[model samples]
Target: MKNLKLAAAIAAAVSCGPALAQTEIVWWHAHGGQLGETVNSIAEQFNASQSEIVLTPVFKGGYEDTLTATIAAFRAGEQPNIVQVFDAGAATIIGAQGAVIPAEDLMTQAGVEFDANNYISGVRYFYADSEGKMVGMPFNSSTPILYYNIAALEKAGVEPPKTWEEFESIAPAIVDAGYIPLAQSHSPWIWTENFHSRHNLPFASNNNGFDGSDGTKILVNNDAIKMHFSKVKEWLDKGWYAYYGAGWGDNQTPFENSEVAMWLGSSGSFGGLLNSVDFEFSATYLPYWEAITSEPTQTFIGGAALFALTGHSDEENKATAEFFKFLSSTDVQKFWHKETGYVPITTAAYEAAKAEGYYDEKPQAEIGIKQLSLPSGDNSKGYRMGFYVQIRDVMNREYGRIFAGETDVESAFNVIEEEGNKLLDRFSKTN
Candidate 1:
């Protein structure tokens, strides 16, 4: 009787092991806070909808930190199946060559029905090569937008600025009314995107670093860029802008507390603002310079895309593809957009949301869609260059020097261009 009971217990334990051993696929990403919750919820939904594969979402800090961790993992031969890299890291990922499997091929091999045409052109172009092959799958795409506290604006007796000139014109008045006209966090990287997009100027040669490893140029010294910086400096001189220090997390607090009347930040920021702001708020298209011949150009995507890391088994790769398809589904995409305030990557998803009156009910959400839908010239698609994340740091440093009156505008631009080009040259040769 003792021998029989031992055999039965062994059998029961063995049976439970297989049930618990689901095929787990690891996903490393740079999303935290509310965005992180959205990612986990999507993974949970996908897991519930299917039993063949399980996705594990891992939080890997901010963009730069995530990239560093991914590189280290790859070097140590323990990379995740999928990694989310931001736009600034696009060139670096593409330049990594054999380290990554093109997202398009992975999806194709998985036998998933994916139509490349279904994605928005602006969003797709950034992740694709010259031959129109996608290197990564678009995820959590966002464009810059203007977020304003309605009560603050009303108290200051100012409307939302429609043009760059208008924004500058009202800065002094806002200051006089005891409101910060603009609240800037010490992040110069965000300013780079806003400045380049507003002027519709190219940040680098060869399709903003997308064309190839050979094309690289810095446009910091361009007349339009200089003008924009001058305007920022002017605002600073008039005490219309307040520096929020180096912590970006605390940067948005001024706007949330209705201390600042206006803010230029990612459209994804809407979710946080919605939760934190007690006063009425409105979002509008990012303001552009009235002097530019063409105003309101398409803004570049700021968020991350999902890349397939090499070394996954065939079955795992196929599962990843299937998961990508599941994410692209109209219902899932619409749900993500509504929940996270990210722009829907697929046209079908956008149309579905429109049909459901999602945009009508939340009018502020339309600002992102409108910004992306703007006419795209070569200048408007998005930036794709190596060492871009580093270049952004350089920009921040130089801009800070200028704002602190450490250097004149021309001198600052000259130094930034020279230093930036050196990094670009080195990245080009190494990649």
Candidate 2:
């Protein structure tokens, strides 16, 4: 009887061998709703492709919340194997010594081939360290662009503007046609930081914190930015532009409902707008201040990347690298790009889409890629400022006062520089 029982136990163990050997890698991310569903689908596909690794994705609120939670968990020695961090937090994570395994190191240590050059330079620059090593896996990258309601433009008898001057000139007509001429999210990323990059204007010293955080100071209150905001203040005073307060989504409704003719939004907004909006629309490069420069330079990318946290075992790191490899595959990149409207992270993925006539069918998707592919200068490489989340908050507060007419544009910008420098100083001291 004992021999028979041992034989049955052996058989049962043999049948469940693969299941027992599978490694589970927990990934905490900020994607929710439809995006959350897509993340799960990717994980499912990866799991199905291999019996040795299983990805468990957990939604942990928005980007800021996810970052905060990850930090707290790390201090408690209970962090997930992977976490998605937004561009704003890239510098913070990169400066976090011993908190993360740089993506390049992680892949190499796990025997997975990773070439930093495989990523789009514009997208990769944000997550790379001083040695050009990628600190995180580029996942969803996007640039700011102008989205206009097609029907609204027709009704207003005006075409989309190419320059800030043209936009101001056409604003009255758009307003006369019973639609708000312009609306933009109060997020400083769109209005200030990216605005600076698009025009090749420096937002800070030390090469925008790329060289080092030491001695880095805010340079945003210069003449170029001042001139830009002055125009914005004029538009606000004339009721040509609508301010919908701060953050990402507050300004989207007016554009979606067609009450606003044009809005500045992330390139990723394309996918969501396609599914939700009732009206036809098109996107173009964001308007530049032609007076500031002869033409606009490349825009900086804004999106999150996956970072592998420390304290995970070698097996978990191997699993994480495998998942990252799957993510960078052309097929998966194309799917993610199509589903999220994020720019494809690699040239191969972009070429795949181009070869399939995907761009012809969805031209809006190509605008961001074109903008990011444009000639880049020092200022356009990307911001690597520390504590940028807090810097953005300061920009929001001061810029709000300017929009509300509580303070002049110059005064608000000055306050931004002063307050921003204080924050930078704090970061420098700590880091």
In TM-score terms, which candidate is top?
2
Which pairs in model 1 have colliding backbones? 209-384
**Residues 53-164, model 2: lDDT tens digits:** 7688999999999999999999999999999999889889887788889888999988998888888777878787866788888888999999999988898899999989
List per-prediction Cα lDDT, in the order shown. Answer: 0.80, 0.87
Output the lDDT of residue 53, model 1. 75
Minimal lDDT window, size 10, model 1: 5-14
Assess candidate 2 and give its lDDT. Answer: 0.87
Against the correct fold, how does model 2 do in TM-score?
0.93
lDDT of 1: 0.80
Most lDDT-accurate candidate: 2
Query: In candidate 2, how many Å is residue 233 off?
Result: 0.8
TM-score of 1: 0.90
Q: Weakest 10 consecutive residues, lDDT, candidate 2?
A: 5-14
